[model samples]
Target: MKNIFDKKITNEIIKRIDTLTPETQANWGKMSVSQMFAHCCVTYEMIYTEKHPKPNGFVKMMLKLFVKNKVVSESSYPKNGRTAPQFIISDEREFGTEKKRLVDYIIKTQELGEQYFDGKESHSFGKLSSTEWNNSFYKHLDHHLTQFGV
Candidate 1:
């Protein structure tokens, strides 16, 4: 997995994001380009803000057990795989707005660096090592950006 904390990798990811446009269509999945941007932002939102509710204890445990491995692993996601409810974006979104937010969040995560996330508590998964955090963050963005053919 690529290191999200590395400045070069972060800039490369931003370049991929910059290639997207309002009219970009997914190679699979139901999301519009803007909705995909919002969906990608959900991960960062969970990390940096209190906008989304943390899962209850039982739910968190289930996620950690059943979902954590897949999310934090180095494997690529299957096309149009099931997503968490929090990540579903059914409504319309402003393309430029969501794109900017996603870019900003990526920059913030990179700036914070690996040490800051060494044992960070995730929204759904429990505390994770920096490698796990980097894998989760980079993989998701890579998956979606690739989905839109960027």
Candidate 2:
């Protein structure tokens, strides 16, 4: 997995995001460009904001047992795979706003650097290594960006 904390890789990802426009169409899947952008932002929001409610004890346990490995491992998500409920963006969103918010979150994550995430407790999973954190962030962004053919 590419390290999102690396300046060069972060810049490359941001450039890919810049390629997206309101009129961009998905290569597959149902999301419009704006909804896709908002969906992508949910990951960062889980880390940096309290916008989504945390899963309860049983749900958290299930996530760690059944979902953590696939999510944090250095593996690409299968196309059209299931997404968590918090990540489902059903309604239309402002393309420009969602795009800008995503870019800002990427910038914030990069600026914070890997040290900030080293051994950090994830919202769903327990403590994660920096490598796991990198994989989770980079892989998700890459998947969605590729979805839009950026």
Candidate 3:
């Protein structure tokens, strides 16, 4: 897995995102480019905003037990993998707005850098080491970017 905290890798990922446009079509999956961009934003939103509700104790336990490893691992996601409820963006979104928001979030994360995320408590998955944070962030973006063939 590429380290998102690396400046070069971050720029590469941003370049890939730049390749997407309002008319971009997924090679698979139902999300329009706008919806996909919004979906991707959910990850950053979990970190930088309080929009989503935190999981309760039992739900958090379940996520830690069954989902944390898959999310933070170095492995790539399987196609059509099950997403959490918060990550499902069913409505149409304004493509340019969502794209700009996603890019802004990426730039913000890069600016904050790894120190801000090292040993950070994730919204659902508890405290994550810096490597876990990097893997989770980079892999999801990479997967979705590849989904749109960007």
Model 1 scores worst on lDDT over the 10 consecutive residues at 17-26
Given candidate 2, what's the lDDT at residue 71? Answer: 93
The root-mean-square deviation over C-alpha atoms between each candidate and the true structure, in angstroms, is 0.6, 0.8, 0.8
- Candidate lDDT scores, in order, read 0.94, 0.93, 0.92
Provide the lDDT at 60 for model 2: 94
Q: 14, model 2: CA deviation in Å? A: 0.9
Compute the lDDT of residue 79 as modeled in candidate 3.
88
Over 44-94, each residue of candidate 2 has an lDDT whose tens digit, in order, gives 999989999989999999999999999999888999999998999999999
Q: Report the Cα lDDT for candidate 3.
A: 0.92
Candidate 1 Cα misplacement greater than 4 A, ranges: none
lDDT score of residue 132 within candidate 3:
91
Query: Candidate 3 regions off by >4 Å?
Result: none
Clashing pairs in 2: none
Deviation in angstroms for 48 in model 1? Answer: 1.1
Model 1, clash count?
0
